[model samples]
Target: MEGSLCDLPAGLRGDYAAAGPDFTLPQDWAAYTPADHATWRTLYARQAALLPPHAATAYREGLARLDFTAGVPDFAEATARLRAATGWSLVAVPGLLPDDAFFAHLAARRFPVTRWIRRPEELDYIVEPDIFHDAFGHVPLLTQPDFARFLEAYGQLGDAAARIGALKPLARLYWHMVEFGLIREGGAIRAYGAGILSSSAETLHATTGAAARRLRFDLRRVLRSDYFIDHLQPTYFVIDDFSKLFGAMRDLPAQLAAARDAAPIPPGAAAPGDQPIP
Candidate 1:
């Protein structure tokens, strides 16, 4: 369950056709087997139960607005609820996508989710993001107005950064904030990042695991931090408010430039300037 698209799960195969320049594909809803839907139900039930204590309230609210339960969601139905809520729609993709293509979709208010679900054995770990991870993990939060805009701006900024070879810093930003970040609510820290959202096991580990480091969220610090793609993140950056994240995008281009000169620090390490969470 490590590495990039090249590091696919061993001995598993699916003949997904090549994707378009935009990385959009057909969800092929009818193609899902009983086992596929079963996998969805299993993962959804377990993860949903764990969410209340550790996840952000927005996530739970979004689920009520557009539920993916009862089975793997039909793209049209799911996207309709989302579009009605926040002008965001879910689109299908083959799998992992090129950064530019991904950004382009986000820039247009479309979230490209991998079309296929993971194998049953891969319920816990899969090298590439499967439908469960992309949909259940990510789509709910996109239903919120402010969070939706933050993602759209991130995409626009990412498109610009990709051209100037400055995408790496922004990629780190997405990694820490979108995938593994935390936020404070009522004096309690909770998980909002998708990587923590979809995985029941990781959610429990992140919120209470003795070895995890919970740190204060700082923009430049996140941009300069390195992370492990294949392991539970060793550290999590907690934001006090969602507006703090949205406001940063106002100067993301400038921030990316300033951060360009700073070398990235690996997970579990912090820059001297960081306001570490206690």
Candidate 2:
């Protein structure tokens, strides 16, 4: 999920050939073996325990509304709660989809959750996103109104960026904000990005560790910034609130164009105008 759309892994376990034009497939809830459910339970318990102190308010509250602790949730059941909360629904996808296909789903208020769950041996880490990452990590936040709006706006913007061939910069924005973003909450920095919330190592590293520099979210700064996919991020952009995240979309097309022309800021490196958080 951290890589560029073009860089997504091809060998992920999913029925890609049987997928519809939209790249969605049945979740096949009943087909999951007991071991698969046990994996979800183990993953859920570990990550859920880490969330309370480090996770954003919206994420925690939204997570409480659902019951992922039981095991892999039935999409239909989870979708019902999500729909009631934010007018959004979940769709099962093979794995990661192409940029346009992904954008279209978000624009239409449909989230494409990967149908497969990671094997037990791969619990600590997985190269690609699975059901646990897609459902537990990302789904909860979709229940928040402002965050929901920001994502939808992001999807809408993706189409425009595609036409202008500026998806690389747009992807950086997604990497920084949607995947690894932080926020100032109650005088503390909290993790809201799915990529951080889902991983035990990143959850602690991003919230409490001293390794990464936390910088205030700036549209231009993020657009021109680079990120790491295989390791902990060296720099994270923090937003004050979701409203500001949604507001960034107002001039994103123009800003993305400008960023595409500018030289990229290397991962972990600071720029002249960056406002570093303590």
Candidate 3:
């Protein structure tokens, strides 16, 4: 989900041609090889083992309610559970999609997940988001009411951001908060962002490594910040609660404009007034 559509590999490009107008496709559950399911299980077990001490409570609770450990989950089955929990459903897609199409799906409460799993060689790293990243990393949080609402609200704002040429800043909001954010819980920092939660290295690095800077979340600073997609994030914004995340949407348009007018803050640099979360 983090990569651009242009970044899709040439071989995988066929999935785009086979996709429907909305870029939606069937999960083709039966096509997954036994090896594919094994990869999912390995990734699941490894990440799950590391999550208890580092993951956000909401994410852990949501993950507990789903059955993703045996193998790659069937989208239809996962959809049923998600819809029952928070009015959200899963739809299969090729990989990264056009911005408009991606947002439209989210606005309708349908999450578009990649249908293919990563190869054995790509177990530790994949250039683009694979099924593991889209489903295992992102889906669990969709079960939380506030985080779910926040995502829908984000999708609703996509058109406006596009209209005003403010999509860059808007994307920064998604990158920093939705993909690589951190949170303070019970006096310790925890990971809530999909990007951090999904990777074994990042899960540890983001929570305990001294290399990255963790600052208290500030809507304006986040909108003006730049991030790295090819490597672990150098900086992360920490939110006090999901409610505050959803509340920031109230003034997003104005903030987007202001962010567009300001120079971007470098990935690991802190602004003068940035509140460091220690």
Strongest candidate by TM-score = 2
Please provide TM-scores, in order, for all candidate models, with all chains considered together.
Answer: 0.92, 0.96, 0.95
Q: Model 1: per-residue lDDT, tens digit, 96-139? A: 76676778789899998888888889888887788888888888
The per-model lDDT (C-alpha) reads 0.82, 0.89, 0.88
Error of 2 at 173 (Å): 1.1
Best by lDDT: 2
Worst 10 residues of 3 by lDDT: 1-10
- Show the colliding residue pairs in model 1: 216-277
lDDT of 3 by residue, 1-278 (tens): 33354644465633787788788887899999999999999999999999889999999988888878899998888889999999999999988877888888889999889888888999889878889998988999999898899999999988888888898999999999888988899889999898998899999999999997899999999999998888888898999889899899898988888888899998888788889878
Cα lDDT for residue 237, candidate 2: 90
Query: Which sections of candidate 1 miss by over 4 Å?
Result: 1-18
Ranking by lDDT: 2, 3, 1
Backbone clashes in model 3, listed as residue pairs: none
Every candidate's CA RMSD: 3.6, 2.7, 2.5
Candidate 2 lDDT at 40 equals: 91
